[model samples]
Target: MHKFHLSIAALAGASVIALAAPVQAQDTAAQAPDAANSDIIVTAQRKQEKVTEVPISITVANQAQLERQQVNTMNDLNRIAPSLEIQQAPGQNTGGGGSIRGIGTQTFSAGAVASVGVVVDQVSQGNANISDLFDVSRIEVLKGPQGTLFGLTTSAGVINITTNAPDFHAFSARVRGELSDAGTAGSKFGNQVLQGVVNLPLASNAAIRVSGVANMRQGVNRNLTTGDLNDNDRYGVRARLLWEPADKLTVNLIGDYARARAENGGDFFTFIKTSTGVGSEIANCGLVAREGNQNYCTSQSYVGHTENYGGSLQIDYQAEPFTLTSITALRRSTETGYSAASNVFRADPLALQVANGPVNRHLSLFTQEFRISSPSDQFFEYTAGAFYSRQKQTRDPETLSVMLTLFPGMTIPLVDPATTGAGANDKIVDESLAFFGQGTFHLSPGLRLIAGGRYTTDRLSLDRYNYATAVASNTVLNVGNFSWKLGAQYDLARNAMVYATASRGFKGGQIATPSAPAVPFVVLPEIPTAYEAGLKTTLFGGWVADLSLFYQKIKDFQAQQCTVDSNSVISCVQRNIDGVKSRGAEINFFGKVFDGLSLNTGFIYAKATYPTGFVGTDGTVIGGTQLAYAPKYKFTLSGEYEVPVTSRFNGFLAVDTVWKSRIRYEANSRSETTFRPHWLVGGRIGVRTEDDRYSLSVFGRNLFNVHEPSLIQSDFPFGGAANIGAIYGPQSFRQVGLSFDAKF
Candidate 1:
């Protein structure tokens, strides 16, 4: 399947390039009607310009494109971006992890941080907890390493989201709703959302704008044994206000609050059967059932709630030669969960030992940045900035489990043991500060030079206290790095530029877990450097294309593990691998073939391999092998067309498809049953008023009903010489829905 997908992608690329040949020649003939042309302006480079002008690898999904494609979240955007992937946690559905450029953390450990960074309205949402989206303008995805401009968290590039700001124009409002079904047995869901934006002209010199969103979704799936809802229920609300008192300076203050209640059945791999004499699947083994008198599977559940709030203030001043901007943002989140214990499978006969637990996490983040930029029209332009961020996180998790025994002809009552249960508490504080600058110098009429550098310092302090084992630990680490970038761009024509760059990225150091009940490990972080060359071009006058080839080397990559002491208390640990290398090439193109017709396509080919041998849990060497979840190929294709239906109405149609090559999800030396390949195709059809004030859209996603496992793990719980294989998340299948939007 992996080979087949790659072949298809290669063929498609060849076909599209062939089709572009004549289109490029006809560009001059179709150059008229500039206003009605389907050209887009983007701010991906921090300045508004034609998409074809930037000499970087980027993909833009504008507001109209998002709405037409029914994209409401980052997960939805993943379908059209080949190098990106998202996955939910083990026991809870509310939180998840994301990866880009084949670098991400897949563990459920509380201390783990994401490799990818998310930005909203220029404020950093770097943590894994800030994944929600609401009231957004557009999303800009920059592929490859983005260290120079995006800082430490963006080792795998950046996802910059610009939210819809307060409209200075009169009152505007919008409302939308959707209903969906999982297609699996006992699954159904629905969502309702209301949003509005209003602008008030206070006197002649001031204006105020307010925007708010309210959303709720019903849960689906009920636990067969507990007769309780298994997966469902989500809702949140956000509001922001903007105040502008002067023409040259503007102050924007924003605050939002969100809360949700949901249940989780962690990674529902097929259920286990109880005894051979069992009457039914539910009556087999309490929560663990025997499949064929030998194999068994355990069931787990979780109920969680999360609340978040944040506010930011921005001040901008515009001058003749330079502009100064200052932004300050602060945010906090609280999360709590109650879950049933996991890993209850046994080959021998035993009654289920029930374990119920709760975990809580509190997080706070603060950031301040000041920037000064030169005017855009000069022969030499520059941007210099100072950035700072501080984060604090506290976590407490408790679990209680009891052992149970039963006889064939006797009834066993479930009882809690007198053994003292164990609990763990952790507090983490991290701070980062950087001084960065970027400059563009015109060397000649057609050649330009660009260079950027950032000096960054990261400090972390961690304290852990275990109540069950009566052990406590504290660690502190500080690291510094100077990352720089140099690039040269040569314009081949009026709207084409070819550039090459050398850049570097770093991930911070962290405390590690001990193996074999010995000394604790404190591993240093990883540093990845990339050498890339790319071409940015405009063809057919309406088409924008970008292609890049990159090679990256990472030293000391961080990974996860766990260790137990003599007292049977477990401690989650982090470790560092010696070295790894990744090399890849990406191609992306978007164009308007004719009036009201547009198409977009992208492809990525990557390979990640370790040079030296690394030891696995069983002390086997894994060398010259591929890393986990790093596929060889991934591609995306989407097209949309708009047609006039009448004098007052228009019709729209679109098709989107994604294909992913097979990936190994486990350590290369340990297991082999970890690859999965899948493809998804979807479409949308809608009708809208000519003025774009009102519209109706009906869409179906994952229409092909491809069920592809997003994650796989082997040797998960190496207890007593048994290996467990766990898989999570396949595409949810076809979902059909209708939406309505209007401006009032």
Candidate 2:
């Protein structure tokens, strides 16, 4: 039987889809003819440029569009952006599993850098809490390798986020309140959210804007063992100040602090039964019943906490023939979690503990960048900059493993400890310095040539400590590399352009965490070469379509190799895989059909394949064809339709749909490791006054209540006989909520 979750949101969405008739323009979109073609300003190339004019594949999601999509955090963008995919990889932080165009960081080590650059306000968010997307001006998704302009972390791409600037001449205030399924039986987070912003005009040249959010929502997964909801509470606030003393100089100061506390380290719904069967998945394990967020655990939950704070100062001075800019930032974050808890299962009558222990990580990073650029619109435009950053890992993770009781010779012979947990005390310091420059030469009135290069050097040191043995060790690593790119663009017409580019990107090596008397593992740098061609055109008056074809090859791919002993104890080390290749094409379109309707669409067809060469624990070479957790195709659509119903009231509806191909969950391309493809539909409809001061709406997502597990893998030593895997897909259920917004 196939049916959607029968909720209020579905009833509203059905009416909207019927009336809007194929569209994604947000409700707040201006009722103007150029709604779809409204030029979105972006900083993809380290400079402000129209999305259609830039020589890169980009996706822009503004505030109005974001609200219509019901975007709450970074992962929410997956529904609207084709290039961004948030996979829930095991043993990684929240943002670590994010991938762009099938390439992303999938490691449990702090030494490894992300393939996508998570940048906020021109500052890198190494370990910062960037979940809060409210008050943001726009989020730009730049596809393909961008190492030359962004940091080495951007071998795949970048998520550039810009916040709203303070208004210098106006005092403003706004508030948003959301109440969704608040305490609805076993399906409630008491999900009440209150967000407010205020801007004050200080002096004649300085203005400050501040915003804060208090979300009383948490995990909705109810644990049968403990009768408690696995909850993760998040709260944060940020402030920004803008000062313009003169016409030639501008200064912006920004600061933010955020913290989150999660129950059982956010493992509440992660280890539910894999199948939707009527009985237990494992024989004698009566704890197993149904699937989805419902879970049955033998052990109780634990607490996981995280705190993040950061600030940045940006100064821009325009002088002579060139503009000078500098940005400096400092950030720190700390996270704690108990990894091996609450997932233990014991088919036997006795419920002894299998493993228990706490692991913690701390980070402090500082970065500075200075650049000089020729004025825009020049025949010979150029920009040069130097970047420096230092990151310190003060407290590395610690682990303690307990022995597992093995029940051998029985019909089912898998270890099921009903038991007890690691303490590795390692610290690391990494410093990097780089010099980069790019030039765009207008060869003719309609032709341009582009070239850029960056030279980077890194020095790292580590301190390893073994408390049980009272011994300490030190290790050091140093490396240098260069990234460069060359490209050309031809103006086919006033609003259309064609471009081609070839580039080599570099990501620094990794020095694994300390593991005692043994030497620390060091994985060398990852080098990637990319070739791309693209077309950006505007036709049918205001329809803008952008297309790109790209092929990227990565060498010395970094990977985490782990092994589980007979005791079911897992240990991991960083390793370098042979290579991987990803080739794909993307299309993004936005246009206005009429004053009341607008359309936006995004699509991607990428094949990220891993070659056949991974060294197994047994020293045998094992490889897979497709990249784990990466889908070959993805399509998304969004739009808005607004029609005035009365002299003082307006009716509007917005809708979005996302469809993704099936994906493999692990390194091996076995049938059991694959999952079926799925599609999602979401939308919101509401009415507002013509003054645009107040508005209300009904919103919902995953309306079908589709049970799609973001990850599926064999719990090898636990699931006797068939090793019938475990399931975990956070926020997979249907959600319907009411939201209200007001402005003054």
Candidate 3:
């Protein structure tokens, strides 16, 4: 609480200083020649607009910014965007999840759906994976519900990624490579990346573009028994074709494929307890090991791999007053892996080891959309669209094993056997259809009224079979809902605006895999109503600042719950909390403080809590507790300076830092699952050709070498032990690297 107050006070002071400074009576259109701090263009409203002119809270990162920040994957985005939080899924490294403003999904089951949606090239992704960042044009992060414009309805927000399109008038090629080493004892060349892109003009009206990336990195964690574990080797390729057969018509086709082969990072046990008889045996296991130790052990090699491929076709036609667009897309992905319950192994007194059965999953998705929009220059502008999507997923049967050193000679059968295999094969299918429309009415030259709405219907079905018991079950759900948004914006002056908005968002309900015959198999949907007010301004003709305050009320919040049986086997279920409330404030600024220098800063303060009737798997009341992975306060500061060393060369330096308050890993809020506050610092220095055809640079990440755990989980007691055990996710290590780029 003290930290939160301090952060707020600091922001208030900065705001006061910024407002009190002498104002320059200059037009924003004729600002100083600071190309590095120019106005950012965004498409948050499904149309092109200046960031400062948009009513909602948003962040934009262009290709230059992404390269400077070294944001290659989803996890790396948090360094620049503090409100976005990401974590690796339990027992897996190749797949993970993210949340915006405390709304997200933590379960990896086929029945679960993510509250946050990820969109690439107008197509929604079924699952979150390591995204390849080669040949990307821009990334836009929307901070509120976007149900009315996007095909997928997510309660949280959306991440919109737009890749570079082919250019018909030019032929060009580029190559970039990087080499990095983990700054830790016994660490090797940990990260090596190579990427290339080429564009060829087939004719005056047609062009093709191709891009590929190769990435290899050594895992920071090690296994004493199996040398180097959790290493990464991945490759991806993308191709795009653009054709303009007529002056008023355009078409684009895109295809991409990616594959990864790697091992998941070993888990670190933060806490362990056993029966009193094995006191010395438990004392020998250490809590932390940089390389590997007996405490973190794996008898069999753990491996994970994934293959993903997708394609999309888009068409657009320009009319005198309106534009028509159509998009069709299909994607498929497959993943397989093995994970151990405990990374540590012991042979003495109470030797205990457990491993998860093989995991296999296959998923496919298809979507289509059609839209029409009026020109923005009109007094009344509007857009209307219809969207359809279908998805199917399958999970194969899996098994689990538990062994104890004390009972090595004893062979138990049935319930207490060394291995238990689940014969259940699960399948899930989902289909959705929606129609949405939005319009803006200009009351005056500087004031506008905006209204939008969406009508959606969804059908979900699940099938499960248990091989051991020969029990089969099927469930189906049909849901329909309406979401709407209303807002008004007024320009206080030509360079400043203030807006207010009220909106409603919805997520479809889900079915739970029955742990037993008596438990319920369905959970209700979630709905959140939000109200917000914001200010966007261009100050001093060279600085841009945006501030927003929002409040939300959620009913029937869906959350994941788990049960532990007498044999210590865990089963998952989804439940609905009665009520939850979230409120927050955000402030952002980007501008040139002086010639040849630029600065970007942001701050977020959020409080997300369950208001009533929230219970945990352990039968503990969790009312008034914070949501999982939601921190109270977050801040980021970054700056860069560039100077012309000569007419043909330029030198630059950049640095950034981020701070986050304490956060709980789960809704239960157990002491062992809490993560303390941490800070990270990173920087870069480089020299490049003035024309930007070639460059060389050096960069360092996690400069302070902070070892903060990204995730933690508590396990039920095994072997009749009174105390429970806990597992910790791998922490990112500090690294330094050099990179070079060439263009032709």
Least accurate 10 contiguous residues by lDDT in model 1: 23-32
Please list all clashing residue pairs in model 1, or write none if there are none.
219-232, 219-233, 273-289, 273-290
**Residue lDDT tens for model 1, 73-149:** 55576765777766654432212355666766555444445566777777776453554565566677876556666
What TM-score, to 2 decimals, does candidate 3 have? 0.87
242, model 3: CA deviation in Å?
2.0
Candidate 3 per-residue lDDT, tens place, 1-744, comes to 232234335434544543453432211112212233456677777777777888888766666667777777666767666667776545333223667777666664566666667788878775535356777777777877788888774677777777777776666667666666543322322676777777777999998989888776665544444544346677899999999999989999999999887664334343344445444444553323221121333445666777889999999899867899999999988878754342323222335544356668888889999999899987888889999988888888765555545465874333322223444678988889999998899889899999999999999888887664567878898999999999999999887999999999887777776533332277777888888899998766656788989898887877766545554555556678767777899888776656677777889988888777677545678888788778878887777788999999999898878898888766674665566787877878999888677788887777666655565444533442243444433234576777776665
Q: For model 2, what is the alpha-carbon lDDT of residue 360?
A: 78
- Per-candidate TM-scores read 0.83, 0.87, 0.87
Task: Report how far residue 214 has shifted in candidate 1, in Å.
Answer: 5.2
- Winner by TM-score between candidate 3 and candidate 1: 3
Candidate 2 lDDT over 219-278, as tens digits, reads: 455545555556656788999999999999999999999887766545332334333321
